[model samples]
Target: MRVLFFSNPLVAHLLPQFPLARALRGQGHTVAFSTAEVMAPWLAPEGFELLLSGPSAEEVTDEVARRTGADILFSPTSQLVGAYFAGARVDLSLDEALAAARYWEPDLILHEHLDFVGPLVAAVLKLPSAAVATDPALEPDVTEALTAAARTRCLERGLELPSRVPSGRWLLDLCPPSLERRGALSPRERIALRPEPHEGPAGPTRARRAPVGDRPRVLVGLPHAAGATAGLGPVLRSLGTLDVDLVATTPGDPGEGPGLEPGRVELLPFTPAAELLENVSAVVHHGGSGSTFAAAARGIPAVVVPGSEAQQRQAEPLAAAGAGLVLPPGRQDPASVTTAVGRLLADPGFTVAAHRVRDEIAAMPSAVQVAEWLVASVSARRGR
Candidate 1:
């Protein structure tokens, strides 16, 4: 079977799909990724074919501003977020996406939750598409808004809109039981798939991790999205005061951030979360699902300083589950973050909760199993 993983230009959304891609490829199925040209460098290391379509996030944001005068990053509402992804993104990306999909002739299109272009391609081709749900689409109202915006874009493209959000078809859920939002999907339509942290290079193992230092190693990774940087500099400075060695991520020059003595803080660019999580005691991140799940999967407690509502959404459930702590903008400070990390390192309960989540994730269907299910589901649906 041939599978095409589809998303807009967001790396976080696309990251969850990689495990399944690995599974399918291992089983001798063809796999490719479809997105803008900007994502080529990101996915190149994975060695998947890039169908390459659509505009960069900046271009989409620009189009949204020109069309609706809405700045999605600054003040994001459901309607504007819908416009950013479903409205402007669809309008700008549909033609190229259609061309790209036509050339690839994929047997199935697995799209990220917020992406509409893939389903549109499926609709145009009369093919089956399922959602690789990264985040829980908890709000039916927000889904409706996305559907409405997609409807406008579809009409403009002389195509029909999908009947329900996600096209209300098969949903491959990555969320665990405790962190799942209320009323996200019907049991009949939702398929549980285990979530794994994005793996990077084969680095040190748990046994090999002793060389760094006897002191606890804490990872401080904020999301790379625009406006998702909150308390990164201050949090780093505070953590430096503690007895823990730090691992922080930087998209640009590692030399550009807050200065700490050499070997005190390690700044990495594009190191896999799996590699970084190894031997780490706890995590401090922007509460992105990518980071939260990575830490939880390894039973590492976390301190979440959210930079966006989406990040905040991930933080709330984690704190509720006792796996982590949340520091909103009002409460986020050098001292608060330091105390949270310190508490996480010292508290046994948090480790217990983190282990609970890890076990729960382990109990979910593995990516290989889900890949089989995806192929069977699509094959049956298409009568192939």
Candidate 2:
């Protein structure tokens, strides 16, 4: 079977779908990607054929901002969602994606849940599709908003919106059961898959860092996006005071700050957090789904400093599960970060809880299993 994977122009959105795609390819199926040109550099090295679609991420963001009269780069969840799908961002890509789908003639499309064009293309082609959730905070309200926007687009294009506009034939849940979204009955079939770590192409091999010593090692992973580093200086200063070796992953320089010890802190450009989690005792991050699940898979506790309401929503469940702590919005000062890291380091309960979640993640079906299931399901549907 030929499988096509679709995602928004963001690395975070694309990474979660790779493991399953790889597994499908291992089973002798053809796998290709449909995304914007900006992602071509990252996808080409993975050996997947690319069918480029849509405008660059910058163009999309600028258009959304212009239409919604709000800067989409830093907008809140509701505003960003409204501006992205309700605006012409999704529509801009729809035609290219549909053209690619028709040419590729994929039997199935596995799409990140947030990318609306994938489902629309699948519906138009009458092909089965699966919505892969990259984050844990897939609220019903958000789904409804995206669905409504997609329906309007469908009507405008003279295409009929499938009964399942937001969700596809399957909803791929990667979140641990404890962190899964509640309070909504999804209209599609829910299939749980273990969250596998797949960071973009590792540039080049470097000498591995020395193994952890007596001091605890912590990873601070702030988003690479512009302005995501705001207020991060204070957090780093707070973390420096503790007797721990710190490794921070940033896109550019993480300028020097008050308490930063050069010898104890190492700043590198965009290494996969999953690779770093193996040697770390805990993680402090912006609570992206990739970062959260990477730490969870390694049984590392985290201090989630969310930059948006959507991130905060995802972080709350980890705190509730005892695997992490959520640094309150207005209180993300140096003092608060210090206290949270201290708790994660000094308490045994957090470690125990993290290990439990790790075990649960391990128990979930592997990518190969999910790949087989997909093939079987598609065969059954065709037989019917």
Candidate 3:
């Protein structure tokens, strides 16, 4: 089987799907993963074919800066909503992504549906495609409800719906089921998973902090920060003042604001996250599916500060399962972040809950099992 996977250029969006792609390839399927130039090298060592498009990193940074500055006065919610709508209209990169898809002549097109161009490309080529949701907010149930309301909106722009819902043979709800309260689906709708990342290496267990004098370890990340609220800097600064080893997911950005001074934060740029969370004491993040599960696989407690409705949507499960704390975006001030961090750090109960969920996730099926199910579905439909 030849599988062509389409993903946005964002690192978080691409990493979770790599395990699934690698699993398929290990089973002797031919798989090619495509994304913008910024992501080419990151996916290369994993055996995925790189696909470049649009501007280079410098160009994207410049554009994002100009746009962000121009829109900074708007509320974060407004700025994000405007950007999301604008992106659907101007996808110059889609042509490049589609060209790569055509080159593969794939048996299936797996994509992050939010990219907006994946389904269009699949339709044009008459290829079967499955939406690989990176966020629990886009799980089948959420999509079903949103799609029903969005049909008129999408049709207004001349978009055509598939004859039926794009059958998500395998909806990779990357977050532990407990961390996605409203987003959790029936057992049949989700791919069962082991507590460990099947394809990735194990996580860490300790760290030595030079800047603040090593104390305990904390994994700090905001994988969905590209267009989300920019608030991690202050939180990082406050945490840096504490006696903890602080490791941030990505390198510091100029506009990310205070608390990212050199030696204070460890930036794990393009490093696979599953390998980083193994020995961390806890996580402080914007409730992203990838980060949530990466922490859960190790039974690590969390302090989630959501940046959008989609992120807030994930807070329910995390709080319900006693796995983490959820602080609203507007309210995620220094004190709130400190309190959440303190609770996760001090409370042993949270760790116990995380371990309970970890045991359940570890017992679930691997990506290989999910891939086989997807193949069978596609084959049966073709035979009909």
Candidate 4:
């Protein structure tokens, strides 16, 4: 099988798919990736064929805006309304995907559910594709809410109402049903893959964790997407007052940001996220699907700060599992960030729940099993 994937750029976005990619490669399927050029260096070592989809976040955003006349800012809410209209400028991304497909001629397209172009691209090419959600889409209510929100965004963008919306062939819900109230899957969908384990170096064990003390070690992840940064000065100053050591995952040049001095905060680029989760007592992240899941997989409690609706929706399951705390931007303050971090470290129940959920995620079938399932699902559908 020749499989192609379309996803957004960011280390976390690519991490969950690694295990599946490796699994497919191990099964002798030719796998190709179409993502930001920035991700190519990191993904090259993993042995999958790479295709650069778009040049910069702005270029992609501009193209999406030009193609659909949808304001980029409205993407957060517009993504749910319908498939024809997009919230973000996706023109270049859509073009790149079509261009890649022309040469790759994939047997199937496995896509991130929110990419917006995957289903359309698949339809145009007459190929079968499945929606692999890094978060929960099993809840019809959530999907409906997204649809309505998206519709509102389109109306604001001056785009016409979409006459048709392409339905996905299958929905790959990454979350376990236990955490969701409406977790049941349709006969068309299959729950096959769980979050894959960190294949990178195992940093340390729970027994090796730093003793609870005044300077609690905290891991902070800022999503690499445009406009995703929140002012960290206030948070850093607050944590400084608390005598905490901060390790922030900002790619390169730690001293570039305010209050992030050499000894106090380490600014490192692209350390495998799984490896970073090992030493930290708590996490402060942008609530991206992969980052949230990575922290949950290790049983490490987190503070999820979401600026977008997709991120807002992604935080729900972790909140439900009692594995992490969600703090939206309008609600964020130095006091809130500090309080959330402090509480996550002090609460024993949170840790226990996080660990239990991690175990559940770990127990899901290996990536090999998931790849096989994806292929089988596509083949069976074609036969019928």
The candidate maximizing TM-score is: 2
Q: List the residue pairs that clash in candidate 2.
A: none
In terms of TM-score, how similar is model 1 to the real structure? Answer: 0.91
Which has the better lDDT: candidate 1, or candidate 3? 1
Writing each residue's lDDT as its tens digit, candidate 2 over 69-136 gives: 87766654554674585446677898888898899999999998788888878878989999887777
Residues 269-289 of candidate 3 have per-residue lDDT tens digits of 445565566557888877777
lDDT of each: 0.81, 0.81, 0.64, 0.66
lDDT top scorer: 1
The segments of candidate 4 whose C-alpha lies over 4 angstroms from its true place after superposition are: 8-12, 35-39, 51-56, 64-70, 79-102, 137-166, 178-187, 197-216, 224-230, 256-264, 308-313, 328-331, 377-384
Q: What shift in Å separates residue 20 of candidate 4 from its native position after superposition?
A: 0.7
lDDT of 4 at 213: 49
> How good is model 2 by TM-score?
0.93
Give per-candidate clash totals: 0, 0, 6, 11
RMSD (CA, Å), each prediction: 2.8, 2.3, 5.8, 5.8
Order the candidate numbers by lDDT, best to worst: 1, 2, 4, 3
Which residue pairs clash within candidate 3? Answer: 181-317, 195-362, 203-278, 204-278, 204-279, 205-279
TM-score of each: 0.91, 0.93, 0.73, 0.75
* lDDT by residue for model 4 (1-384), tens: 899987767555566777788788889889988777878776777767787775555565555556556755565333433322233424446677678887888988877765555655676787888767665533454455444544454455454433222236776667655454353334455665787545542343223335344666788786655543446656776766555678676644444654554567655666676667756778888776677767777878888888666577667778887888888767778788888888887787778888888888788776788789888977887899
List the candidate numbers ranked by TM-score, top first: 2, 1, 4, 3
